[model samples]
Target: MLLKSPWSPRLAGVEGTLCDRLVASLSEDILSGTLSGGDRLPAHRELAWSLGIGTGSVTKAYAVLERQGLIRGIKGRGTFVSVGSARRDALIDLSTNTLPLMLTDKLLSRTLSAISRRIDSDHVNLHPPAVGHDEHRRLLARWLGRQCVEACPEQLILTGSGQQALWLAFDILCGGRGIIVTERIGYSGALALARHRGHPLCAIGMDVEGMCPEDLDRELRDHDSNGRRRLVYVTPTVQNPTTRTMGAARRQAIVDICRRHATPIVEDGVYTLGNDPSLPPLVHLWPEGVFHVSSLSKSLSNGLRLGVLLAPPQGIAQARSALEAIPMTSSPVDYALLEEWVSNGVADSLRDSLRGEALRRNNLARDILKDRPLLTDDSAFHLWWPMPHARAEALAASALERGVSVTAPNAVRTDPEDDESGIRLCLGGPSRAEVERGLSVLAQLTSDG
Candidate 1:
C-alpha cells in the first residue's frame, strides 16, 4: 500500500492558481515544521484525488518543491521530504536590517497601475529634472513637514538610495579633500564609501548617549586649527549597530561643537523614519549647518530605493550640480508611484505597521536575551550583543554552526585599533518565528561552555 501524503490545505479561500497555492501551502508546511524531513508524500494521483485537484497541478507543485530542495522522489517509490529540508528551513537569518514585507505584491501592483493610468506616454519618455520633478518634490516636502524638518522642494534632491545621497554629500562637502569624522563604530556603508574614495576618516569615541561630545569637540578643535575641511556624519536616532539614541542635550552639544568650528554635518536620517519625530533630527536642530540624508528603504521596503538629500541653503547649488553631474538620475516611474502611495496614505499605513513590527521584534529579542548585555532601543530592529573580541568572534562562528546567521564584527568598526567588540543581530528581515528561533539559538550559544 502506498503511503498517503499528510497534505490537506484549504484551497477554497486562498489566492493564486491551484498550482501556485498548492506550492505555497506545501512549502509553508515544510518550513513551519508541520511536515518533517523524510516524511513520505502521496503519489501525484493520490494527492490529486484527495485534494480534489488535477494531477497535473500536483505534479507541477512537486516539481517546484524538488527544485526548491524541499522534497525528492525515487523511481517506483513515492515522494518524500528531502533529508536536508529541515536543516535548510531551520537556517534562520538575522543579519539583514530592514522592515519586513510591508509592501505586498498586490499593493505594489495597484500603485503601479494607478501611476500608469495617470502618467502620459510622453512623460514616461522624458527625463525628469536632475533635482527631481516638481510634483514629486512637493509631495516629499509635505512628508518632510510631517517629520518636522521644514524645507521647500528645492532643498530635497532625489537620489537612487541613501548610499547615493551620502556619496553626493561627500562629493560636495568633502570634495575628496576634507576629513570625515564619525563615531568609532558607525554605519558600515558610510565608512566603506570613505575608504573607497580615499577620503581621510577620523573615528571619535561614544558613550551611553552616543558619539562622545567631548571627543567630537576635541577632534573638531584640532581639525579647525589645521584648517582642514571636515564633515561630521551622525545617526542620532537609533544609531546603527549600537542602537543608541542621543538625548536632546547631546544633540545640542553636537550641533554646538560643529557650529563652533564652522564644519558641515551630514545627518543620516535613514533609520529615523517611523520613529518619534519629537526628538527631531540633527538637521532640524541646526538646519543651516547640517545635510540630512534619508530614504524609504529602512521604514518601508528596500526595493523603493527612494532617497532624498536635504541640503542647507548655502550648499543647494553645489548639491544640485553634483546630482546633475551624475549620468543617471532616479527612475521617474518610481518617483511617480511613490507620489501616489504617499498621496493615498498607503505609505503612512505601511510605515505605521512597520513601526509596530519593530516594537514586537525588539521586545522578543530583549526577552530572549534577557540576561545578556544588550544594546538596543524599542524602535530599533537590531541589537548589539557586547562581548570580548575573541569571544565575539567565537560566538558568531558558533551561532552559524547552529544555523543562525549574524553580522560580522568588523563590519561596523571604524577603527581597526579600537578594542570595542560586539555582534549586531538584525531582527527586521526574518519572520517573528524565525527571529525567535534564531535568537534562541544565539542565547543557547552564549550560555554554552
Candidate 2:
C-alpha cells in the first residue's frame, strides 16, 4: 500500500480505502524503521494527489500517527518519525541552554585588562563593604537608575545573581508555611526554593500578559484562611518559556490587585533590562510594593553572575538582613570586573549590541518558522513555538540526534500541571552556524506535519 500510494498516478475511485491502507502501511514502516529519523515525508497535498486520495484522508491519517507518537512535526518544518523509534541516537542538547552569542573578543580583552588593573591595585585584598563597595554600588546604582528612570541609587541593592536576590526577597516576605503565588508554568528555581524552604506555592493561571490578576486575587483570598498575607512572584517582562511581555494596562491591573490585597510582589526583571526602554518596569510603577531583581548574566555575561536587587524602602531592612545571612560578601574580582564594565560603559555597549543581535536572530526565526505562530519578543533572546502536535518529547529527541540541543517546556516547570508540550529555542547560546543548523532541523520538523 505504501509503495503503490507513493508511485500510483490515479486511484480516484478507491481513494478513501487506499488512504486507509496507506496510513496502516506507513505506520508499520515507521515502526519497522524504514522511514528513519530526519527522513521527510512527501508534502501532504502532493502525497494525497499521488495516491488519488482526498487530502482530508491523508490529513486524518497523519494526525492519527502523530497522536499515537509515531511521527513528529515542527510547524514550518516537515514531519519525521520519532527519533527514539527511528535512530535512538539523534541528540539535540537544548536542555539548560545558554545565549547563542558571546561577548566579542575586543570586549573580553578590555574586561580582562580592567581586571588586571584592579588586581594590581594595592587595595585588592581588602574586605569589601557588606552592601558592596561604594564604587561598585555606585556603578550598579547608576546602571539601574539609567534603566529605571524613576528609581534612585538608594533603591538598589547588589546581589550575587538574580537567584540570590529571589531567595532574599522570598526569605524576607514569606517564611515557613506562608502562601506564595506563581505562574502555572513558572520558573523552576523559584519553585525549588519554595519547596526547600517549606513555603506553600500556589500555581496561578497565566496568559500572554502574565499571571492572571483575577486568578491571583482569588487564590490569595481563598488561601488566606486567617487573613494572613501572601507573596506573589512574577516575570512580567519577556517571561521565560512563554516569552510573553505584559502590556501597560495589564501591569497596572496586576499592581492594583496586589495593592488591594496588600500582597508583596517579587518581580523578576532579569531579561527585561537592556531591551525595550519604553516598557516601564513594575519596580518603576510600584516601587513601594515590588521587589525588582535583575542580573548581568543574561544581558552582559553569565560568568559575571552579578545581580541587582531593588527593594521597596519599607522592605529594605528585612531584605538586607536576609542577604547578609546567605551571602555576606560577593566575590571582589567579579564585582570589580562588573564595576569596570559598567563604569566604562562596556556593559551598556554589550547590551546594545546584544539587543540588535537578538532582533536579528528573532527575525531569522520568524522567517524560518513563518508557517507557525511563534511566541516571542523581538528584542528578547528566545523564541517559544507551540508544537502542532504534542510530541515535544519525540521532537526534542529528534533534534538531539542531530547535535542540536533545544529545551522542551516539560523541564522548565516546577509542577507537573504547569508543564506545556512546546519547545523554547534559544538564539543566544550557540554559534551562528550551530544555531542555523539546529533551527534548520527544527524548521523542517515543524513544517513536515
Candidate 3:
C-alpha cells in the first residue's frame, strides 16, 4: 500500500485540466521554496480521495511532474521531489514584470469572503459614468495619501489598466493632435499607446538621470508653432526599460522648461511608489500642468487592473468628459475588493513585500552580471544591460536558445537616433534563485560582448 502524502494541492485560477493544474501547482510550489527537495507527494489513490478526483488523474499528474524533473518515484516509496529539481532546464523568463504569487495570494481568501457578502444591482444603472463610483475614488485618494500625494474624489478618474490611463491622458490632455515628447527609450507601454493614437513621438536625448532637459526644451521650443499643443510624457522614478530616475534638480528643470513653453506634462508615476522617499512626484510641483497616471497593477497586483488618473481640480471636468465616450473604468467587483484591501491595510503590506522581493532579485542579477555595464536601482523591478546593438541582438537570440527570456533592444527604443544596443531584464518574476540562474546564462553571453 502507498503511504499518504502531506501536501495539499488545488486546481484553480487560469484555465487548464485537473491534472495539468496539479502539475503546475506542484512545480510552482517547488520553485517558490514552499516545497523543498525530498518532499514526498501523496499516493495517487490518496490524493484523488482528498481532491475528489479520479485516481487516474492523480497518476497522470505524477507522470507529468516526473517527466518535468519535478518528482521521482521509488518502487517501495512514494514519489519525492528530486534533488535540486526546481532549477531544471525550464524556461527562465526575465521579460515579464509581475509580482510573486505568494504575495498576491495572501488576500484572496479575505477578498472572496468579502465579495460573497455583496448583492448585485446592475439593473439600477443602465449606463454608469466612466468617472467610476465615488466610494472607490475616495478610497483611492485615501490610499494615495500614504504616498505623500493629495487628491480628491472629484479629481480622480478610475481606469481599467495603466495602459487605459495613458490613453485617457492622451485623449484629454494632448487631444492626439500635437507632437508627444518622451525620453529616447521610454516605457514600452506608453510608446505603444502614443503610436496607436497616431501621435508623433519626439524622442529626446538622455543622460544617466533620464530625459535630457536641454533636449526637451529644444523639442518644446521647436514645436511651439501653429498653436499646436505639445505634451511631455516622462517616468521620473524607477523608469521602465532603463530602470533610471531623475533627481530633484533634474525634475525641476524639466518642469521649468515645460512651463516656459506652456507645454503640459503627463508624468507617468507608475513605477515611483516603491522608489526613494526623497524623490517627490512632479504633480506636487505643478499640479495644473501635470497629468499623473498610476495604478495598483504594479504596486498591488496586475490582475486587479485598477489605475487612477488624477487631474488638478481645474482640469477634472474635461478629463472626465474625454472618458465618457469609452467608459474606461474599473469594474464593480474589482473596485470593491481593492477598497476592502486598502481599508484593511492589506495593500500596504503587499507593496512592502513586493519591494523586498524585487530588491532580492536585483541583487542576484547584480552578482551574476558583476563588473558589467548595468543600469539598475535597489527598489526597481528591472535593470538595463547595455551592449552593442548588434551584439545585444545576437546575445538575446543566444539566450533564447539557452531557455532564458529577455526584452530586445528595439522594443523600448524611442527614436531612430537612439542606439539599438542593450536589452531590458525584468527581475520581478520567478524566484531569486531562478533569476540568478537566468542571469548566469546571460552573464556568459555578456562575456562575449
Instruction: Name the best candidate (by lDDT).
Output: 1
- TM-scores vs. true structure, each candidate: 0.77, 0.73, 0.76
Top model number, TM-score: 1
- For model 1, residues 276-342, the per-residue Cα lDDT tens digits are 6568788877888999988878866778878888988788788767766783356777777777877
**CA-RMSD of model 3:** 11.6
Off by over 4 Å in 2: 1-92, 104-106, 114-123, 225-229, 387-390, 418-420
Return the candidate ranking by TM-score, descending: 1, 3, 2
Return whichever of 1 and 2 wins on lDDT: 1
Residues 1-449 of candidate 2 have per-residue lDDT tens digits of 33222323332211113443455556545544556755667768988777777788788767756765667776877666667656433333334435554677887787788688655353366755445666666667766666664555566677788878787778778866676788876665676677767876777887878789889878766665464447889988888767888888888888888888788899988884444566778877777899888777777776877777778787777766665666644566787777777778777777777778888888888877788868988777777776523477578656644455565444445455644547777777666655677788887876765
lDDT score at residue 444, model 1, on the 0-100 scale: 85
Task: Pick out the ten consecutive residues of candidate 1 with the lowest summed lDDT.
Answer: 8-17
